[model samples]
Target chain A: MTISSRSGSPGPDAAEETTVIPVVPAQDGADETTTLPPIDVPVLEDEEFEPQADRDATFRPSRAGWAARSAVWLVLAWFVLAFPVNFLSPFTLGVSDVSAASEAAIFAIVGLSLNVLLGYAGQISLGHQAFVGIGAFTSAYVVVDLEMGFWFAVAVASGLGLVQAAILGAVSLRLTGLYFALVTLAFGNFAQQTVFAIPELTGGEGGKEAPRPAMFDSDYSYYFLCLGFLAVVLFLDWRLTRSKAGRALQALRENPRVASSYGINVKAYTLLAFAVSGLFAGLAGALMAHHDEVIVNQKFGFQLALLFVLMTVVGGLRSRSGVVIGSAFFALLHSGHLLSLLEPVTQTIFRFSLVDFITGTIGLPIEFVALVIGPILLLLTITMYPGGIGQQIAPIREWMLGRRFDRHAGKVTEVEVNDVRA
Target chain B: MNLPLYEQLALALTAGVLRGAVYALVALGIVLVFRGSGIFNFAQAEFGTTGLFAAYWALEIKGWGYPTSFLFGMGVAIALGLLTERLVIHPLRDSSRVTLLVGTAGVALAAIGFQFWWFNETLVMSMPKINEAFFMTPWGAVVTVQELITLGVLAVVAVGLALFFRSPSGLAIQAAQQEPVASELVGISVRRVSMLTWGIAAALGGLAGILAGPYLTFSAGFLSFGAVGALLPGFMAAVLAGMRSMPGAVAGGLLVGCIEQLSSLSILDGAVPGAGALVLFVFLLGVLLVRPQGIFVGKVATA
Candidate 1:
């Protein structure tokens, strides 16, 4: 490992430099600087050179090797991104499957929203379902009631999300840590039960129609439309981390007292994070509504909120790719495509339908798989792998980006979000 | 929807006391766990549900007597509490409170999943009440023997906890919570204290579940997220107690219960479909805004 470290870090030179520096300083003052022992010099050199063989072992592929790798990567991207609409699609992705894929994209957006709050801001929101639910209902209302354009409906939904989130932040941001989590939870329940209860807006139990834009009416086009929105959100998230506000939010998360001393407006930046999160959530919700072609209040409940948190944490906090992949995994899990894809192998080997067999044996519902297994994964993520999916995939990501694939490249530092000064 | 104001007030009071007993029971366990662990244990209510499920399986499926099933259920809750402390909480002891809270919630979600797996939604189940006798309150409202039992158990547990705190083991728990390192230096087994705290908290939770189960149908996460869930209300009560006081938690529970039941007034029912939920939301906001610290207790020393 140390020999491999030659290409990545400065271990070899630093050790030699340390030994030589003490000896050279003896010229300044022989009494002040103690000379190193003669025996210690060879031992140090041998220690530095012991792992020498591995320095040449580190993989650095040739031009042709790079070309092959890039070609393979290109085909993989094409298969994932475009093959479903093209004739070469596997698994025979039907129209509903395409719609389900759109849901996956939208879920990625939602997961990113959560990453901004829970990961970047170090704030917990168990009630985030209300944020998305409101966005979906608001967009549905704008298009159905006000006869607005699709973009206009989306804009209005985003605005409402920002406004509501700002109000919530203003009212309860003073409540730090778990108290704030409790407040948001109580508020979420209130919104679901009361604010959403109004028939004019949420349309009660009957639900409301949420039609797709005219240009993106087909399932394939709508899926791309959602993909386009996901790209926009991803771009915004990238810009956020690179901006001054993002840095300030990170500082504040580290220590609000110190951040305040440094002249950062902790409250404003927190509210800003909240608003940004709300905007993305609202946009995702709008896309989800149109993708479903209808919206209902019941779909946005405590379980949905819990699932949002699950996907975000499991995606690897502060990692866009991790969040997206995790969200997509869950979306497929929920849609049952991932399970159905495994049906062939299970049928041939086990000689029975896996889903039906489980349902028959344990009486667990199909959708409950995420609920049952998600928390266990989350527990594992928190305890054994703090960086989650992002950390696991980081080596590959770095290798693709022309960097040495150091095993610890994406290791997450301690994110102790306590009122205690850690 | 047009009942007399006096009748509404009377019914609200009666309903509040009965409902408040269960909330008090749940709140006491929550406060106990928080004091011992310095964490907002979100799985507190789930403990009750676990016990309820255990007892239900024993009674309904195994055809065991009520007393044996109840003890088995309490035993299950204790085991779960021990597993949680050892497996989840102990491993993540250095994690932030947020991470710890999430861990507890994960424990809850896993338990809920197990419940759903073993007892699917297809089975509609309810435990038998302790008694079938009904009594009339002066408010013209009906009172059940089960409710009286719940109230009696709450009283007994509250007094018992007070006395326990004065005992040697209870003092050990307090020392462990306040000065874990110092207590360890002095030869107190802080680890054992943690186990003891969780076990007792879980036992209290088990009592709440067994006593309250007769009032509603049993299912997965029944005590945590069901229609008869006491989780949110229990938290509210703990908050009202400044997250520290024991007796304060009891009083706060009654206050919240009455406030929640007040939504059952005909006027409120006529105006809103889920008046109880709306009232709880508004009242929680009002209390937090007005006091922030607590109504029943002095300033909280820690977060």
Candidate 2:
């Protein structure tokens, strides 16, 4: 496997002319001089010399290639797995499927957005779920009480998210790291209280329902809808990371001071990053509202915020695969059937049902897999394999191919390596 | 709306002072952790709730009764704090502040999970009545025993902390905070000092929780809210003390408490139920903008 390094700076050949000298003590009555050995460097052909070109040729695929090959393969796999479950399985494709998939999509989007903030921007936001909650409530109000169409509700939700992020970004840009986290946390709690107090708008603890579009009444259609949104978001994310703005964002993420010195507008870029992330999160929340047909306060609590953060960290934030893979893994865990699979084993070993085992083991309600699993996974990832599963497997996959998995490099390059150090 | 000016003023002042005391106690716990470890204790409220639950268990489950249960609960809380510091905080000593913060959050979540597991979902602790009645005044204002105790506790803790800081161990802790390597050279154990700090902080938080639990409902959710409530006042206290001065933290806590209470009683009555939080946000913003260091002191570098 060929590994290409990005170019540093080009400079004149000063190394050849430089001579090595050594100093000796005056008491020794001798001036010591040493000559350095000449360096041996490999000379390569023009084809081998062009590393960037070689890397690009090896990895970058045309749009048509992905659409025709990867897209088809993904679709086939989805159908293969889903067909049996939908038709042959005894379980009904009712609220469970819709809830699980929708929640996963929402979390995935939240994770993706956080990748830009925490993963890319090097900023930690403990209150990011506040934006998600805001988006959910906005869409719920629009779709249910205002009787707006689905698209309009989504658009409005995204718009509100943009505004909220803009305000937060402006307020918090001056603060660094922990202070920024604190401010955002306060804002999140404030938002939560505001939502609670405005019972007229949020329906208080009772919650409000968001009617789904006529076309997506069935679980299959709803799942596809969610998948479609996921696909678009993934594409947008891919496109974003490739653009000038994306590179600039990455630069700022690494070192805002350095990026600013290089003529990048730090504040503007930070605000833009926050807004874009909020937009995607809002879209996800809007979809969640429609899919669940309910907007409850409990769904967007602080615990959920922490869960989203944990998912992003566990998913190898900054890589599309990391977010998608982590989302799917957690989604399956959240499903009741997955938990039910352990019932017999738990019953035999612990003399308790799976639910009891889960409750005892995690010290929380068994239903709260997201809470228990998210934090534990976060701790495990940070303490042990901070690069996460996607990162750990990437090298292995490349090694197995022998020719290097260059095609995946572009998506993986954005993953923050420094987080692993922490 | 048409209340006499004198009555309105008295009510605002009394409410501010009472609320301020609660704020101070909560913030004091945060101050202890921050000063000793150089890390913000996001789990302060959770720790407090753990103490509350322990107290609940002693009183309700073990049938240890009120005052004894309270003492038992505090003892349990101290053990939990020591265990947490040893297992979680100590191992993460060299990690980045961000990682430490996130780790504390995990600890907070775990604490909540434990609360959920031990306590029945629907069970609520019947808080002992420490204060039964309020003394009415001609000015249409009343002072309750609960308010008095809350303020009294604040006073005692503040004074006690000041006195402790004057002791040899306190000096050692101060030195440890300033220069751990140097302090170690001078024959101080940084680890022991930190554990002591954690134990004291947790104990303070537990006391606050036991005192406040009767006022607010005790539940698994209480920790999350309680932590948040503690944040602003505690943070303000830390900032005011330059994050280094004990007196500054105390004064800052009292100020935050007063502002929050006054805001809640006056402007926030029916208009904004989140007036306390709003006031805190404003105070934080002001602190950050006008004097990011603090009102009375400069920035004190944490370990």
Candidate 3:
């Protein structure tokens, strides 16, 4: 019910700053802004008082508090980096788990790529598997046949991804809403059936090898390399979303007509979003090709497209941390490590192996766990927890940032993926 | 022996029409749901697949009579439609159309996953045709009695729907769809009408799956991505109908089918890989660009 004003970092557009949070409750209908304005003027004009008295009351952590927070932050960082390699850890993890961690990072990249389209631009692509698959095949062909290095293959793949997305962006201009989604779905099928079936490019059904980059051949080292790439992508995403282009995309997504009227080039920003999404997808695909050492056409099916959407939405659209965690969680589920990780907890609760219960009593295979449970989770997320894991963890993130842990700090009013009729 | 060009065209036309029958059925279902609830109903094709699996289980696994199994499949599909309307669609009715679309897609994925889980042991499965007899057309393309039955069913259903619209309950459905608030004031239960429309659409989809399943071996998402892949074509057909007109849907389905068959011509055989899918894609884009209002749908006056 409270409307919080933003502090620091004044944006170029003052109007945008005022309307950014449009968080006033719609049901109330009574405008509360006029009733209780925060008068910044001094209250006690007759009494002598220190000028900085109000500012001194603001919560700034003491030196010891800062040290404790830093220690906790370092532990969290170590858990992410060191846990995969079993360095100073209690649990035993084989190389396969480490490799799976690499896949998780790659999945996070794909999820972020989707967030650009679905979250930022409000464009849903049902054929993202095609986008990623083309990248995978392009990378593999460049590396294996042309004898190009990994970095060059990656560049080519990302470039090709941009080209393909531009082509689709043209179609998207003609079709919006469900019609555009249908086109993407058809494109995905076409890619799976025709493009990937080419014996020359994809090596037919057998697939083609994509060698790991030189000096990072070991699994542990490769894991670090994936993490480094993930960090770069994260940084790029952060910078992009904070730029004017990001603001333009948000404007277009809300109302293209109004945005265009305000001198924003809706078409250009939309294409930019598509280009960025495709680039990230391509980068992930190239990484995936080398991670598996071989890329096959079958891996980029419609199911994978659904999986990508699932991760992005369930991760909570537009929430970077949520998308990363959701994608990694699903990746772990796909790799069958999630069940094993939960085995001890389930055993303590249910007095039996939960993994065994799922595979034995339920007759669901480990690999199929994500497919079966993911949709259920997606349905629940959309219907009940619209903000998803990101919204749920907002308070903690605020607390970590040395702010008050207000439970409603990052609440999303409503997911605005509707009425995209053009 | 290579066929003459005329003969090849004849084969393509005949095959296209036969295949178009199934597309028409699927399109009818899509149009119905779109008209009734304004949902794209991504689960429309999955309903058929789920029904086909149910029928397969009853006939193959449970050793039920064919007629009984077919009815059971339709029953299961209708049940699923009602369940979907109650659980996912109704709750999301006030949400955005895209959210409803995503919800239906989620329903579809769940159904596909359940199919995979239930029928995992049987790696490949096929339903028996109603009649095993086949006759060769003048173009040398063989036609099965099963296909003839499919065509016959499409005709009957189309005519039946036309006549049903003249009936009282059908009028209620039409009224509710056009003006739900006014219809409610007039004592028509809008909720029941929605359930009825979804049930009928699901039945139509189930019919398509049961008929099309015999054309090839079936698996999870058969009508979606298998040899009989009808989801995209069905959507194309619905689009060609402007997602509203039933008769237009039938015509659109036939037109889309024939257009897709153009890829199978002898001249274009090896030149284009996945020619059928590619042809369909291009045809869809062209239709959307040139006549997005639909080739078959007549313009209606808006107030």
Candidate 4:
């Protein structure tokens, strides 16, 4: 049928019609005498083949559903804001705890940055620690040595991230898959051993003292600033995924050859994604440096990069909420304060601190909890649940978003463990 | 030209060769696993570190004889390799190569954690050198006995691999690597070959760690990112072989080593901190950008 024959909706009459797919009998069609009648196969109705836009009609919740969604959103806002500020909450948060919360928010931003490349672009970056590290050092140097304000420092850091990432993206034009991974790995080592070692830039062993911005000096205010940045990042990420370039990334990632055939500039779009990812990472890094007040090179090591990857993977590749949660979980875990908070739960569960329990039962020291837990979660995430935490929480998320809480809501439409290796 | 400058160049060259030997040893394992499984195993370095740690415990803590400790270390390495193949690789065999790479990385992380747990109390663990003597060159470059022995070991391993590839079982491994389904159809158990390949690779990694550990003050993840960050260099060496050729991997390792040693030159070191890593990073980028197929490998259009 021609395009003109298709309608917005199909009538019942179309259901009666059928098409047949040829059924070849006998091995290699050797037994021609045993030919059988053609079998009927289902054919797509004109309405079924309508434009993709018409098919994905948005779900409109009822009045009560809308109210519930509003309530849920309000709770989410309050939880994120008041919990960190220790205002209008059951318990007050200390300054360091508030700082940890800020770090968590920054980590969520960094995780989102990785999701753009690994999730949407189907590209891998093993040297992401370097990306974040460069941003951290850049911002620190700008703020401390150059004596610039926080806003200018963040801008310069993000620009550097964009430029460096674009250069790396250019490399991806020639090399991909494992080769690209190797290059990133090399770059990470370079950043760690060489770039971070520059005495002037990193400010030697004590590191550069990246004091908080004048206005947002208190932990409470800085937390809000980070939250604001995270909100901006989240908004940008949402817009990118819905934008033309984002769809192009998804298509090219599925099959570059076909995408190129369809007139997509594979190199240009991939570079755009790299720039976007790098921008967010740089912004997050700058935020993190200021969060600590004293930035050091040791924080962003190879293991940190590895943790970032597995955390994102474990969070679920393309799921925004999942990645953010996973990133926050790791950031909290890394800071050690999260474990202390969990001590009460562990005491009730195992009569000792979680670290002691792990050492006594699992034979692992407390210092390496994430080192062990992260991997187990990663393996489980990839093998059994490719959707990660996002997939697991999808049904609840759908319900909260004014949709029916269907049991199979989070069914993995696509199972990709970092693409199909080209 | 000044004689001192000539001596410095000679020393750098000598150091590069010795360093490259260790990289080549690690590269062999990388190439083996990549060929047999078509997955880039990031845990290769951990296998080395694990073996080194196991040996350290035996020789130092338990006071086992050197020969027995060496055997124990190799045994541990083989066991760990087999376990990895069974636990992580087997479960994710049908997954994407990237997923497999992630799985191997998980294995590496677990090993690193275990090492830290066991050796957290110990600081700056050092492996005893096999021999104390050193051979001095005319240019004043000192070559330790351990370095000479490592070079000799590499030669023997290369020759052994050359010979193995010619044997029946070796041919089976080759067949399995090149065409797993076809080899299976012809009665070759691809599973056994896979296990064998990983085992061999792990042993090689272990040997590299045991030999190289003496050259530096070692710790957990030593081969991966410690004082001797051999993993990336080893990978570059494998990339130089186009991630395929066995003999080419060793040669690539030596080349990478020599190039890396260039950063130790006083001129570069004085000019910048971490000059060696900068040189390595530039070299890796140059290699992939310039000749991704490697100098020795034939070029073919690929996805």
Q: What TM value does chain B of candidate 4 have? A: 0.95
Tens-digit lDDT track of model 2 for A269-307: 888888888888788778877776767876766766776
Those runs of model 1 whose alpha carbons end farther than 4 Å from true positions after fitting are A1-61, A345-353, A360-363, A413-422, B298-303
Off by over 4 Å in 4: A1-72, A348-352, A359-363, A413-422, B1-3, B297-303
TM-score values for chain B across all models: 0.95, 0.89, 0.96, 0.95
Clashes found in each candidate (C-alpha, N, C closer than 3 A): 0, 1, 0, 0
Evaluate residue A355 in candidate 2 and report its C-alpha lDDT on the 0 to 100 scale: 73
* Per-model DockQ: 0.54, 0.38, 0.66, 0.58
Task: Please write out the lDDT profile of model 3 over residues A118-230, one tens digit for every residue.
Answer: 88888888999999999988998898899989889999999999889888887788788788888888899888888888788888788888888877798899999889989
Question: How many Å off is the CA of B58 in candidate 1?
Answer: 1.3
Higher-TM-score candidate of 1 and 4: 1
RMSD of 4: 6.2
lDDT of 4 by residue, B1-303 (tens): 334566677888899999999999988899888877888989998888989999889999999999898888888888999999988888777777777877888788878877887888897999998887888887788899999999999999988986887777778887887788999999999999989999999999999888888887898899998877789989989988888777888998898898999778776666888888889889888888888777545553121
Model 3: per-residue Cα lDDT over B1-303, one tens digit each: 668888888888888999999999999999888877778988998899999999999998899999999999999988989989998888777777777777888888888888889988788898999899999875688999999999999999998986776788777877887788999998999999999999999999899999889999999989977668899999999999988788989998888888888788989988757888788887888888788888887765221
True contacts kept of each: 0.49, 0.28, 0.51, 0.68
Name the weakest run of 10 consecutive residues (lDDT summed) in model 2 chain B. B223-232
Best by lDDT: 3
Q: Is candidate 1 or candidate 2 better by DockQ?
A: 1
Question: Model 2 clash pairs?
Answer: B20-B257
